[model samples]
Structures are given as C-alpha cells and as structure tokens.
Target chain A: MLEYQDYILTEFNIVLLSSIAILIFLIVLLIFEASKIRSKFGMEEEDIEHRLDLLRHLVGAGKAYLFIADKEGAVVDINPDIQSLMGLEPNQLYGKDLGIFTEDTPGSNVESLWQVLRDKKLPFHLQLRGAWKNGEEFMETAEIRPLLAENSIVGFVVSRIGSTDGEGQSAEGSEELEKAYAKEQVIVESIGDGVIVTDAVADIVMMNKAAREILDTQESEIGKSIYEILQLEDENSAMLLPQYHPLAEALEDERRVMSRSYYIVRNDFTRISLAVTASPVIVDDGIVGGVIVFRDITKEKDIDRAKTEFVSLASHQLRTPLTTISWYTELLSGAGSDNLTDEQRNYLDVIYDGNQRMIGLVNALLNVSRLELGTFIIEPEPTKVQDLIMSVLRDVQPSVEEKQHEIAFNSEEEMPEINLDPRLMRMIIQNLLTNAIKYTPDKGKITIDLSRHYPDLILKVSDNGFGIPINQQDRIFTKLFRADNVLSKNTEGTGLGLYIVKSVLDRAGGNIWFESEEGKGTTFYVTIPLEGMKAKSGTKTLS
Target chain B: MMPKILVVEDMEAIRQAITAALAKAGYNVLQAKDGAEGLEIAFLEHPELILVDIIMPEVDGIEMVKRLRDDDWGKTASVMMLTNVEDSDKIVAVQKYHVYDYLVKSNWELDDVVEHIKNKLKAATEENS
Candidate 1:
C-alpha cells in the first residue's frame, strides 16, 4: 500500500513540470514575434520621413511657385519662390487666404483660374493685379496648376509668374500699356503705307489702319486670306504658292522680297502705283509670321515720267545743234587756205573744243535720264574687264596727259570673264576715270585695280586728288548735287555723273562706297556680284 | 531769194535772238508777238514753216498746232513746236499732231532751229518735185 501511493505522487509532479515548460516555450515564441513586428514598424516610419524630405527639397528648388493649401483653400505653407514672387516673406503669408492675390484681379480671371485648379487641370494662365508689401501695385501674368496625389487633389497649388506689364494690370494700371497701344495705333493709321500681317498658315491675322483704309473694307474682312481681302484678279495677281508667298519666301530664303509694281484703284477712282515688300518675323529658330508693307508711289511715277520726257526731248533737240556745230567746224577747217592765219585757226579750234564739251555734257544728261526712268537696259554678254578698263583709259588719256597725271591699271592673273553691258560698263568706268582726272592736281597718280572677290568682281579706283569733303559725302550721289568744294572749283560740271553711277549700280545689284578725307585722297570701291547682272534682266521689264 | 519764215515766241530775248539768227542765216523772217498773231500771219502769208512756242497767251503752241491741223492753210504749210516744257505728256500731244519736231529751248542753239527749218523746206520742195 505505501509503495503505490509514492508512485502516484511522482507521476503527478512530472506532469506539472512538463506543463510549466510548455508554457515557458510558448511565452518565449510570443516575445520573439512581437519584437520582429516592432522593428518593421520603425523601418516604415523612417522611409516615410525620407520621402517627405525629398519632396520638400524638390518643391523648394523648383522655379514655379509652390504653395500648400488646406481643403478650405487657406494657405498652409509657401515655398521661397512663391514668397519672393509675391514680394512677401514665408511667415507673413503662411495661413493667409489664397484669394489675397486675386483680390485686384478681374472677377472672370480669378474665377477661371480657380475653376481650372479645382478641376485639376494641368495649368492655366491668370491675369491678375498684385500688390507688394511696399504698397506698389503691379500687373502679373501667372499660370496656376493643381497638385494632385493618388488621383485626388492634394493640399498644394503651383503658380508661375510672367511679365507684370503686358496683361495683368487693372484698367487703371493698364493706362501705360494702353497709351503705347494707342500711340502705335495712331502711327499706323497716319501712315500712307498699307501694312498686313499673316500667320504661318498664310491667313491674314492683323491689318493696320492704313491697310484697311486702302483695301476699302469694313471690320467684317478681318479673318479673310490676303487674296480674298484684296479681291485681286487671278491673272493680275502674283502666282503664290504655300512656300513662294513673300512672307513664306522670306522665311525660307531668310531675306526680304519686293514684289513687282501692281495697280490699286482707290474709292475715289484714283489710280495708285503699289509696291509691296514682305519680311518674315523670325523668333528663335523658326518663322512665326510675316509682315507685308506696301505704299503708293504714283506721284513718284508721274515725276519719273516727266523727267523721262524731258530727257528724250532734250537729247533730240541738242543733237541738231551739235550736228550744226560739227558741220560748220568741218566747213571752217576745210575752208582753210593761204589766207587763214594761225590766230584764226586757233580761234576755230577753241570753238570746236567748246562744242565738244557741250556735246559731252548733253550726253551725260541723257544717260542720267535713261537710268532714272529705268530704261537704261543692260544687255549682258561675256566681256573682259581688262579690255573695258583699257578702252576707258584711252578715252580719258587726253585729260590725263593734259593734267600731267599718271594712271596705273592692275588686274589679277586669270581674271574670270564677266558678264556685263559693255556700253554701261564703259560709261561707268569712263565717268569715274574722268572725274579722277578732273579733280586730281597736276602730276597726281590714279590707280585702277580689278580683283575677283568670291561671288563678286571688285573694281577699286584710288586717286590722289581733291577728295570729297566728309560732310558733303551724303549728297554726292544726288542728282545735280555737286559738292560745295567741287562746285567752287568747277562751274562746268552738271553734277549728274555720280548720280547715274549710283543708279546703275543699284539696278545691277552692285554696291558703291567711298572713303575720302578733304586733302588726303579718295578710294572708291565698287562691288559687282556675278549673279547680279543676270538678275538685272528682270529690272529691264519694269521700264 | 530767202524763204519767208515766221518766229513766234513768248520770251523777248529768245524771240529777238531767234530773229537775229534767222536773218543772219539769210531767211526772210516774220516776227509775231504770240501764237495768235503767229497763226494770223501764218494764214495770211502762208510761210514755209511756222515756228511756234508752246506756252503763250490767247493760243498755246499745242492749240495752234491743233487748229492748223484742222485748217486748210495747215495742210499746205508745216508747223514746228519749240518749247521749254519737255514733259512726256506734251511730247505725246506733239506726236499726235505730227509736228515736225519738238525742240527744247534750253538745249537748242540758234543755228539748230535755222537748219531744221531749211531741212523742212528742202523736204517740201522734194515732195513737190
């Protein structure tokens, strides 16, 4: 009996000890799991802090002004960029209503900007008047965009500011801009020229007051194409392609183009000679639009016609007298016999020389008239510069020898044959050489140099002569404008030589420039583009 | 015998100078105060050539030419235009009337006008022959 009782007690003790060990193991496992969960939560908190820091830096560095607003549209936080743009510090603007900047804005502009933000649109422009802390008001063009997160509106607004003078001002603040616009309007209205602007698509976008007045159209014609607006006859109108239109051509060629003369009749049944020039408005690397400026040149044309008539009549009338002088001089010389003394012969020679001089002057006058009337047709053929220069040299040789002046001609080896009008070229060179001889002091040196500048042939005439005064340079090429100095020294000059030279050069797409000091000397450079003579054929048709 | 020619001009210096030159050139010259007198004399005497100035009182050179073209005396005699106005429109008008030649006063010498007259007379004689 005593042995049985002891075994039962021991078994109970073993069972109690095993149950306690199991409870201890389960508690240790629970502690390990709880520790792992706490560590994971800590890591998640750290990740969120890092992400927020990155976002804050990004907002601060960005150029577009950034601000955070509560759901009620109260400003929560403002970035430095926004603070500077609004001319306010961060603390001063924090928690202020976002509507503060919009207070002076037009109601429609404010409403539209707000609506765009609320609708979560990408961005929109806002015209607003904003005041600085110093009580100064400014016009501002701003772009407002909403900050979206997780496909829902976040607590932020992003605004970018542009010029404060263009579109942002209230009616009062816009007075300056309005005044400028009015001044431009007045200038455009008062001008006699017609001005038209077209978009890249060649549709009329803007027309100045003169253009509208000239076209004799009402406001209803604003959105029409140029062709429609002008009501041009198909046959008379220039053939314009999408790329060949003056504006478009300017864009493609990167140069301005002048159209041929066209006729425009006014409402009063007055005819006008119209000339058009189209130039492109190039921005950055592309063409945005083009402007066409036109003017009426009828008065100029009439004057030109009158001048042409005078020249034609003058030439014919002068020729008859010249012929008489020539015949009488020949008769007098032929009538010479034993009775003719040396004094008589000398007197006749003086008369003959004076007659020749008059003839030369008349010829120069006729040449000038032809050039001004655009009737001086240059028929270009293969010609040698050397030969042309030599002929000019021969013609002016007598004057050169009479003045005891020396002329030197220098030409490049292998000088390319140039295409030019021999008659015109002769006239040009002869006039220049004659002027040099006439103006130079006795024993002065004159040099004619011909060289090929790539794409052009250059003729330079340098003379140690009575140089043109610097103050009188501008009038040198004006018809009948002899330099004061030249006029004082010489009374026989018609003052038409340089004028004709300039006109001929202009028509041939050539250029002339001279450098002179009153006493030193003068060098005149003439550049004749090789391709320009070819282009002159088109000018001939204008006559 | 020198052929009779009428000189009509507005400028006194030019008219006197022209008369002197023609007389020296051995022509029997008649002088008129203006285009009207010139026209009257032209009809009465039927001079070989009537020298007319363009701008004048009562009748201008162009009007005189137009009247001569319309008259019987005009067909038998020749008319020449002498003027200082050398405009294209004037020339066109002169051409329309088949005036012998248009002369600019500033550009012409006294001898030129005398020679032109002589040429016209010679041509008329040839046509008659």
Candidate 2:
C-alpha cells in the first residue's frame, strides 16, 4: 500500500506541476491583454491633444483678446491679442491680478476683476461703453462669463469683442446705423407736436422745441422729474379733462394714451389745454424710457364752448314765447261759461300739446348745454332715492293717469341716504318715468327697481312699450335721434330725453345702458358710482 | 282771514294765471309785475305767503329778498320762488334767507304749483298754532 501511495503521489505531483504551469501561462497572458488595452487608451489621449492644439491655434489667431482667470482671479492664460490691444505681453500678465488692465481708467478702484465681474452684471452677457487709452477714445465691448461647475462658480473667461474697429474707424453697417440714427433724430426734432422723452426713472432726457413751447417749459427741463413739470388734476376739481387725464397710467401700465386732453397750469399762470399721447420706449434690454407727444387744443375747446353757448341762448329765447303760447292755449280751452264745439276743443288741445312738446325739447337742449359748460357741477345733498322716485312719480302721475299706465316700484332693502345732486336725480327719474308714461300703451305695465349693485346705486326702469328699433339702438343717445318705430308710433317725442339723461349721467361719472327688443319691451339701466359721494365733504362748486 | 298769497312774476301771462289759480284756490291773491312792485305790495299787504320771481327788471328776486329779510314783515313771511331762471346761486341764496320753497316755473303744472303752496301753508299754520 506504501509503494502504491508513493506512485500515486508522483502522478499527482505531475498533474499538479502541469496545473501550476497553466496558471503561470494565464498570468502572462493577462498582463499582455492589460498593456494592449492601455495602448488603446493612449490613442484617446492624443485625440484630446489634437483638440487642445486646435483651441490654441484659434485663440492665438483670433483678433479678440481672450483670457482666463483662476478662482483667486489671478491670470492663468491670456491670448497674444492682448499685446496689441493693451500693449502688454501675455508673459507679463501671467500670475498678475486682473485689475492691472483697469488701472488706467481714471477714478476706477484697482481691485479684484472679480469685483467688476460682480458689479457690472451685464444682463445680456455683454456690455458696450467708451474706453480711452493715451487720450484716444475707443468703443470697448466685452463679454465675461463665469465657468460654472456643479452650481458653483469655479473659474471665469473674459473676451473683448469688436476686434477690428478702433477709434475713428467704422464698419459699413455701423456707418449706415449712425446715418439712420441721425435721420431719426432730425425727424423727432422737426415734429410739429411737442415731443418729450423721459428715462426709466421719469427724468426728462430730451424735449423738442414744439414740446417746450406747448408745455411752457424751457430746454432746462431736462433732468427734472416729470411730475414736477406737470401736476395731476384733482378728481373733484371741475376741470375739463378727457377721460384719460395724465401720463401716470401710460408710464405705469404701458398703455398708450392718444389724443387725451389735459390741463397744464404753466409757470406763467396760463392754463394750456393740450391733447397728449404717451408711448413707452422699449429696447431689447427692457422698457428703458417713454416718449410723450402733445399739442395745444385751446382753440378747439373755445369753439366747442361757443357752440354750447349758442345752443343755450337759442333754447332760452325759444322757451319764452313757447311759455306764452302754452298759457294762452290753456286759457282759451273755452272752460268757464264759454262753451266750444268739440272741434274747437280738439284744436286747442292740439296746440297745447304741441307747445308742451316744444317746451320739452327746449328744456332738454338747455340741460345738454349746462352739462357741456360744466354748469351742472354736482351740489351733492343727502337724498333718499325712494323719496326722489316717489316725487318724480307724483309729478308724472297726471300723464300716467291719462295713459292709464300700471306702474310698479320695488325696493326690498332700504338704501342709505345717497349724496347726489337732487335736481339731477329728479331729472333722471322724471325723464325715464315720463317716457314710460308716454310710450307704453294704455294700461301697459311699467316697473322700477332700486337696489345696491355693490359700491353703486343702480336704478332700472322697464316699460312694456314699443321697444326701440334694434337697427337704431346705437344712436339712441344722439342729440336729436329718434327711432323710426317710435317716431311713427308717438309723434310727440322730442328724441332728446335719453340724450339729456346720458349727458347728465356722464357728467356725474355714472353709466347708462339699455336692453330692448323690438316689439317686446325696453329696460334702461342707470348706475351711479358711490365712491366719490361717500367720501366727499365740502361743496367745491364754481362760485 | 284767508292766507294772502302774492304772485310776483315778470311774465304777464304767468303772473295772471298764477294769480287766478291762487284766487280760485281760496287764497287772497295780490299781483306784481316785477321785484320792485312785488316788494311794495309785500310791504303793504303783509301777505302770509309770497311767490317771487328770480330774474326781474328793477330788482331781482334774490336782491329784493335780501332787502326784505331785514324787516319784520318779510322775516315772518313764507316766500316761494317761482321762476324760469335755474341759477344754483339764487337757489342757495333763497335757502339762506329761509325761503319756504323754490319751484322751477317751467317744471311744474298749475295744479301742482297750487297744491304745493296749499300744503306748505297748512304746515306753516300748524307749526305757528
């Protein structure tokens, strides 16, 4: 068994020796595979080297001065172009502070270029401004950006652009741009209307001669705040201003106010009425400023006033004779002991009614004149709408009874006493109620509703009358517009009631609208803003 | 005695109509053509109620009232303005003189004018009593 064990051991040793040799061979092959893979990686390094060479050639050849700085702002590398631009070699700038180039800038602090990179945060990645060296002015535009890694700034690169353009040198495109700019400047200066340009902070930057004369300002207005030049009109002041008063809205919201009339109380004590427009000057950067244009409209205003005065005078002169005719007709009705034929009585009634219609037309014209002339400045007194409506109803009750109209007045919630011109409120209700009485068929239903429309007092008058023709609806508030359907139905209408109502409401800063369908019914809505009334205190009428 | 109401108007027809209406309505009525004559009639008649016009020839109603308000008879008299002139200053001035009421002549019917006077006179009587 021992000799057999020895032979088995020798065979086992031979097998083990072959296994060791195989392991050694595997080790050498593994080393060979590793070096082969390493050599392939070495080829990739040369590919990176080729890219670096291209970058070096591009940076060296380009006229733009390109430089990179380390985290400490010390120059790591700079292109050869700096030698020609700054008259300094790249070797001299190496290991130097970034502020060395800015030392020649008078009054500029020699500090970290990091300070400049942070201070002049160029919103569009580039900045252009005038730079001087040896008293020669050159337009210097540079782009600087931080090299960011993992959300934190690691390094920075600065590139000075406009490589070929020097002082007194211009490209063909730039020459054309300058020429266009000059033409535009001339056009702005020669504009007929007043033109005033303001910066973003509302400082006056430029004003043409027309603007200076119209605004009663001098060329010294430049650098002054706009509000200092023109004061805002007070809301309660009875100033004749267009709906859009001042340029405040234009500047704040970017709304273009075109041909809006406003008053400018000049230093010379003359109130100049100007129609003005304001538009914002927006560039690629943002809204940088605003441009305002204005023109004097004093002549137009005077002509409008003259027209109103003539209408007022004509109406008053006509009303006197009409009053006499009205009284004579009332007396000549053959009432007491003077019996008349039905024919005579009918003729007298016709004369009286015709005179009354003429009187109504005259009164409406006078009211419109008053509204236009600002004579109807509100003399607000605490008035209960219910009481006013009831009084108006009583005044029109005779007509209502004659027509046999069924009127319903509803006010569920009692409203507080509203501050309003009692006369104006009375006229509004009277016109609406009288029209309802006149237009509706006998025994037709008329409804009135008074309620709070929240921060407003709303009165809605509805009548089951011959509704206005839909085609003529838009012209219902014209000075002498009458709907054809209404004109045919009721020949007595002056067509001035709604116009007078509209003018009165507009002067009071209220709104009037209506909804009507032909042959169905008509509902007129009136809304009075309660904001001014609630806050008003003293009477500021033209005394 | 019945209340003596005076009608002071510049328009002749308006004056006569108002006077006739007031007389028919059972008030003793005195008539005047202008503010000058109205003041004279008001002083002599010492009417309990006076209806005055605003714009007149010799003395305007506002000026006449300003003069009459100093005297005792005019101080106690209940005056109402019946006029075509709708001057806010005149209206406010009349109120300042403690006028009873202001009626726009063109805006009122004859019956409404009479009714308003009767009601106001009745209220004045009630208050005085």
Candidate 3:
C-alpha cells in the first residue's frame, strides 16, 4: 500500500511542474501583447514628455491658464501658469478637487463644463474669483470647455486674468462702457468748430457735426479724397489755396498747416470766411491720418468794411465844414471888413472867434468818430514831443484865454524824439488840454508836464478846477459820458473829448488814467510806448 | 444897386446872423422865417436869388424848391438848400428838386452865399442878354 501512495505523489508532482511552466509561458505572452498595444494606442513615455513640454511652452506664451479635471471634479493636470496664478504647487493641486481652487460653491464650473460637453454647445465665458493655496484671491475671466471622447464629456478649463470679454457681470458695468463710447461719439459730433479727419492717403476718414454743416452734405464722406470734400471758393474772390490742398499739404509735410481766408459757401447761400488749420496724426513712426479745424469769420470781415466806409464819410463831411470855417474867418479878418467901424470890427472879431470855436468842436467830433470806428490811421513817424505839445497849446490858446486861464508848460529836459503819428499825437494832446480847460473854472491855472518814464513818453495835464467825482471816474473814458461836475459847469460839451483821447492812446499802444477829487483838482497822465505802431483798421461798434 | 436877396431859415439866431451879414454886404434883403414864408416872398417880390434852410417846421426847403420849380412866375428865381444834416439820402432827395445848389449850414460862409447868389443873378442877366 505504501508503494502505491508514493507513485500517486510522484504523478501529482509532475502535473504541478507542467502546469507551472504553462502558466509562466502564458504570462510572458500576455506581457508582450500588452506592450504592443501600448505602443499602438497609448502614448509612449518620451512622446508624453514631449507633449507636456509643448503644453508648458504654449501656456507660457499664451495669455491663458490651463487645467484638467477628472470625472470626479478632481484636478488631474495643470500648467506652470496655473501654479503662479493660483499660488499652488502642482503636487498640492493634483489630487485636490477643482472646487477647492475657486471661492465659488463646489462643482459649479465643473457642472457647467460637463453640461456644455453633454449638450455639445458652443463655448461660454464666466467670471469667478480664484483662491490660492495660501488663501489669497484674484479675479479670473474663465472659459470653461468640455473635452469630448466618443461624444462623452471630459474636463477642461481656460482662465485669464482681468480680461474684458463682454460677458456675464453686473449690467451697470456694461451699460457704463457703452455710454462712455456713445458720449465720445456725441462730443465728436456736437462741437461748433469744423473738424475734418483724413487718412494718410489724404482720403477723408471722419467728419464731425460742424464739418458736415460747413461742407453742406449729409452723405458719409469716408474714403473720398479731401480735395473732393473741401470745395474752396474762387482764388480771385478773396479766397486762396496752395497748389496742394490743405489736408494734402499737412500730410506731405507731416506737420500742421494753415490756410488764409478760404471761403466756403454753406447750403443757405451764405458765404463764410474759413480759416483752416490742418495737422498730421502720426502713430507708430508713420503718418496715420490728418485733422483740420475751421473757423468762420464773415461777420468780422463785414464789420471791418463798414468801419472803413464810415470813417471816409465822416472825414470828408467834417473836413468840409472845417474848410468853410477857415476860409471865412480868414476872409473876415482881411479886406472884407475894411469899411466897418470899430464896433463892427469888434463884432466881426467875435463872429470869427465863434467860427473858430465851432471848427475846434467839429474837429474834436471827427476825431472821436474816427477813433471809435477804428479807422483813425496812425502813420507813426519820428516826431518832436515838444513840437506836438506847442501845436496843441496853440490850438487851445483861444479857449484858454476866453476863460482867462494861464497854462504852465514844463519839461525837465529835452525829450528824446519818439515815433508817433503827428496828426493823432496832436489830437491826443489837444483833447487832454481841452478837457482840462473845459472843466476848469474861470481864471484857473493849467499845467502841462512832459517827462520820459523809461521806454515810455509820459504827459500829464492838470487843472485847478472842478474835478471828476470818484464814483463816475470809472466811466469817464466811455464814449459820450460826461461827469456831473463837468456837465453842471459846462453844458455845451459833447462829452467825447476824453473818449477820443483814450482811443488815440490805445491805438498808439499807450495808456491814460486820472486822479481827482471834487472841488480840489484833476490830473490826467498818459504813458505811450516809444515805438512806431500802426493803428488797427476796422473796429466793431458796440452799443 | 445891389440885387435883392431873401434869407429863409428856421432857427432865429442863424437867420438873424445871415440877414445881418447879407445887409452888411450891401444887398437889399428880404427875410422869411421858413420855407412857406420864403416861397410867398419869392412869388411876391421875385427876388434875384433865395437861400432856404432845408429842415423847418412848415413847408421844408425841398418842398419849397419843388413848388418854386412849378411856379411859372418864379421860374427865374434861383433857390438853394441849406442844412446841417449832410447825409447822402438827403442830398439825393434835394437833387430831385432841381435846386441850383445845396450847402451844409456848418460849411457855408456868408461870402460863399453872397458869391453864389451873385453868380446866379449874373447868369440870369447873361441868359436874357
């Protein structure tokens, strides 16, 4: 029986050896098949490393932070930028749930990402705050997208910082942005001055509200040439243009340019005097566009013309009377009165004196009119100040003597020759002296002081007579304004003498002011620049 | 003998001064206060020349000149318009009346008035001759 048992054992050992060898061979075959399948379908270690390197470089260059989540909403992979963005190490985030990376409730972005993948819709953007491992937070504009496999959703999220994607946020932010853009457009359109913008090729790019009003058109002028838009008036008709258009010239020079008196007619048939300034708009080292600003000055031009006409008329009309007065007075003092008695002769003398006074008054009125019209042409030349003063003294001598007044003329030193218009200078001095004599009481004393106040010629005319009231001093230089004191003292004055004096001084680049107290005295000081200055032609009348 | 002259002006001072100057010049002067009175005198005496002021209360000088122009009896009597307002419109209005001459009051000397009247009378005599 023992021998039979041993034989069974030996048989069992042999069967076990055979089974073990078969199992070992099957295991080696399965290992080879698995490696072949891995080579065919799965990524090799080297290939996977290369793909990860590419992804790192892509995330570094792109403005996006990339991440991957598993089906369980757990973070499986992340780029280097994700670490910097969320302040987390890759190891710390790898096994952690993606909900921990966001301050929002868990599974929100994940659920949306899965929903998009399941629905197979277009990608959508979301704004959320991302939390760092250290508990710091930052705003992220995230585009959560689903990775699809055989039409089933995987997990992926792309986030960028501080991007304006025009997406989900409070309505106020979007509305405010839209309003800012619209307001910019309105401001560009509502300005009164004409604004024209052109591209580098001198093609009209943009035109503002006033530009279209000036150009008299409603159609969009973009892409048209500037010369087509700006139709300049005829050159012979007080309008001019260069060989090239203003915008084209500005573009060529790459600088600002101006055009003088470029007339443009509006749709209402009114002509406008357009002064145009064109400037180049440069960007990125090249000319991108140009802009032109235009202003209308037609009213100013009309006023100028009217002023010239008024001056000529006033000068001729006033001069005619002056000529008559002069000729008749000379005739009366000569042989015409030879047969008259002493009383008759004396009467003639009074008439002659009256005529002379009328001439003086008329002359003063003419000066005031001319000065107000800005047509008083000041032809400045080298003149002796003393000579002008003497002439003024001679002119006012009759009035001075009629009041039985004495005038004291004083000059500390010989005044240097100054440049001034002789006629205008005479008018200024005479008006000042006349004001002094007219406002002074009978037998009053007048003093004329002339001195050099460095770079200026100063003249002071003072009178020991009724002075201007303090309250009315501010308006003494105004046209046709006479102080109450002067009016009470003398009612015949036209009250235009000091106005004429002020205007003449202003034209000569000089200034005049006075100091006075009632019942004391009045003193007027005039300071004039020692230079040749021409009077501006054509002033506007203000009522 | 000096030719007869008439002075017409609205202002008393201006008229008196002109009449005195004309009398001193040795002329037989007929004085009137306004254009209507001057026209009446012109028809009655048929003065050699008449000086009239333009701006007056009754029958302004321009109208007086027009009436005198229409009168056949005073056709030879010369008429002149004198005024202080020298606007172009007024000058044009006076020109329409065929007035012999217009003078601004501030511009006319007594001698100028006398000389102008003398020239007009001398021309009339020359035309008759």
Number of the predicted model whose lDDT against the real structure is largest: 2
Best candidate (score: TM-score): 2
Q: Give the alpha carbon lDDT tens digit for every residue of A327-385 in model 1.
A: 46645654343567889888878887788677767767776666656555667788887
Tens-place lDDT digits, model 3, residues A335-377: 5567778887787677776766665566556556555444345
Question: lDDT of each model, Cα atoms only?
Answer: 0.68, 0.70, 0.69
Query: DockQ for each candidate?
Result: 0.06, 0.19, 0.05
Error of 3 at A193 (Å): 6.2
- Cα RMSDs of all predictions? 19.3, 17.2, 21.9
Better of 1 and 3 by DockQ: 1
TM-score of each: 0.53, 0.74, 0.44
Candidate 2, pairs of clashing residues: A194-A211
Tens-place lDDT per residue, model 1, B1-129, is 778888888666567667767787788999887878887888898888788888788888888888877788686567777775555566678678887588765455556767877888888889989
lDDT of model 3, residue B44: 94
State candidate 2's TM-score: 0.74
Retained true contacts (fraction), each candidate: 0.00, 0.14, 0.03
**Model number with the top DockQ:** 2
> Which residue ranges in model 3 land beyond 4 Å of their true spot?
A1-165, A168-171, A177-181, A184-188, A191-208, A211-369, A372-375, A535-543, B1-129
